[model samples]
Target: MSIRISAVAAEYGRGLRRSLDQVIGQIDEAKRTGVDLLVLPEACLGGYLADLSDADSTLVHDDPGPPELSVAGPELAELAAAAGELVVCLGFCEIADGRRFNSAVCFSGEGVHGVYRKVHQPLAEDSYYSAGSGFAAFDTPVGRLGMLICYDKAFPEAARALALDGAQVIVCMSAWPTSRTGAAANLADDRWTKRFNLFDAARALENQVVLASANQAGRFGTLRFVANAKVVGPGGDVLASTGVDAGAATVDVDVPSELAQARRFMCHLADRRPDTYYPPHSMLSVS
Candidate 1:
């Protein structure tokens, strides 16, 4: 069966209400296009904060992080209602047990399906929120789904773990920005943008899974986002993309068939050499 999926590369401002309005509008647009699944950028609800300039300075209090929200809060409930039959995946600042997490949630009319906390904290992001312990895949209306938040996509093991857990489609939501230290004049020319695109293709090809990436666009605080949201087929082909602008990359594909075909020749998952290789910690211990 074919499913219509859309990955949104759009600006999410600081206000939560405004963000919800934007999400509602996107859902309406996706509905018109018969989109079965919609994926929005990381920190799409509360908006991401400025880059961490000081890794060790506790006195740096000028920029507070995004607002902490509960998974069962009214905001997510509203989004779930707006989603209706359409499956929606978006990132948020999750608050639970008085702790905040850089988290992503997937929901539909039936309510929340899955939630993922970002495991890999780049820069000083760990100062703001707690890191997730592991990666997991959950069942959704479209297919077996896995979610990654921002820097989590940088680590190969994260996607590999999810794929091993039976994820057919991996949705990576990012609040990625251009080079912070020496940014290029044009956003498209930025090196980080290239890495973002390369990672998407590599993860999909390696895992033989459909990969959908949604990223923040426009400027927020000191960061200038690179909105290169796209969907990649199992063979690492760019199915649809929003380039470097604020828009949605939509595509229709038969998920199972595409995965089967990609793995038909060489199943990377089936071909294992885990015992022959050294442990990740042991390898890190070497250098």
Candidate 2:
């Protein structure tokens, strides 16, 4: 009942093809190391930028076409093929029916398995991206794998939804931006000034499940996404983490027993009172 997880912090703001190659390399490396799962930075395919003014204008879509039925779409095949024996989770901009959404697509030897559109689009994101309506979890060989994007991790309900849905592994793809003054750049200690944030710990503590986060590295124009990729176990302990620059980390997780034990102790899922809980604002009132 072990889950071998890996997180790849790729160089931020690189071309789609080059970044895909790096991600493939990470997948291959994970395969060689017996890692069962691999996660990469957010927007790994489309590049982590609000707009692709810098990239060839032809690729940038003012009006994105229809959303591909699956990750097997022309743009995502190579990545899906490179997933090999491990499950790969990576992010990309979704072009669906003349609308665009920030999406993360999961690929495995079986092909596209899960897709999650980012729910909590941040302030700047509101201008360029549309918010996703809900959250979901999917079944996998390792366990129930949940999908979440960058800003979605900030919301407690996002993880709760997954946990309630019986997800054992919470996978997050983010491209968090840093300050411009470079104050975050010279942070020396983990106390007051830290490179990595606290979302991973919070999410793990709340859900009591393995939390894996992959973030981009380097500055995307004015945005600075200092790579901080890591994997947190069911007990909210960080198994492996990465620092600045493009790098990768891996960890083996004993998911089944850990999840069972955590649930047995806390028992959040068992104690849920779904029948009694009701929202005041409802389209259809339940009597």
Candidate 3:
């Protein structure tokens, strides 16, 4: 049950053709290295927001924002074909039911396995894209997989839901940027960078599920990204990481064995007492 996972951190901007080329290149490398599952940053298919300064403003910003793409579009088809046997998870601005969603889609050469629209919207992100409804895990060649977008990982309930749904691994795609104010001179010293890394470990440790985190690198518009992609073990251990640079955190881990070892005695999910939870969403159910 050993799986090879690659958490990718790279630059993706407004050019659709360039973005596709960048992702395809990574896929080519992963294929050569025998990666079973590859997770790319949020909005890697198009790009992320130009700036967070006016997200809270009701006034429509002049910037057009990330180009919206359908889950059934040709871009995804092209990625699927390039994926061949590899399971690839990537983010995009999804247009569905007349609303745009910050979404992630999982697919392979065979076809799509599942899709996740980010349920939690941060800051003024809600002003642009409508939030997703819930969290769910789907079966894949790698294992039972759950997906979360950028800010969704900030909420413990999101990851917990997928764990309860039998997810062995969680793919968290993000376009997280450096601090807007009191900006740190170094990327690694940035407080937001620490939180980005902390959330990845915390979610994995608490849920006893392997976590694969990917993020955008470089800068786009008024945002400068913190490219700290990583793969974390169920025990809160950093198995591999790309630091604050643009690259992939690649690792070979035995999923079931790690989960079993970590949960040998203090199984977080099994030990939960849902009955004691508060009335409103303390113990929510996807059913």
> Which pairs of residues have clashing backbones in candidate 1?
none
Tens-place lDDT digits, model 3, residues 1-287: 79899999998988788989989999999999999999999999768877766763323445667888998899999999999999999999999989999999999998999999999887778878898999999999889999999898999999999999999999999999999898798999999999999999999999999999999999987789999999999999999999999999999999999999999999999999887776645546688
Candidate 2 per-residue lDDT, tens place, 13-48, comes to 446566667777778888898988888877877476
Q: What Cα-based lDDT does every candidate model obtain?
A: 0.91, 0.73, 0.92
Model 1 per-residue lDDT tens digits across residues 112-139: 9999999998887788788889999999
Model 1, runs deviating above 4 Å: 55-64, 280-287
Enumerate clash totals for all models, in the order shown.
0, 5, 0
- In model 3, state the lDDT of residue 133: 97
In terms of lDDT, which candidate is strongest? Answer: 3
Instruction: List the lowest-lDDT window of 10 residues for candidate 2.
Output: 187-196
Which portions of model 3 miss their true places by more than 4 Å?
56-62, 280-287
236, model 2: CA deviation in Å?
1.5
Q: Regarding lDDT, does 1 or 3 come out ahead? A: 3
TM-score of 3: 0.94
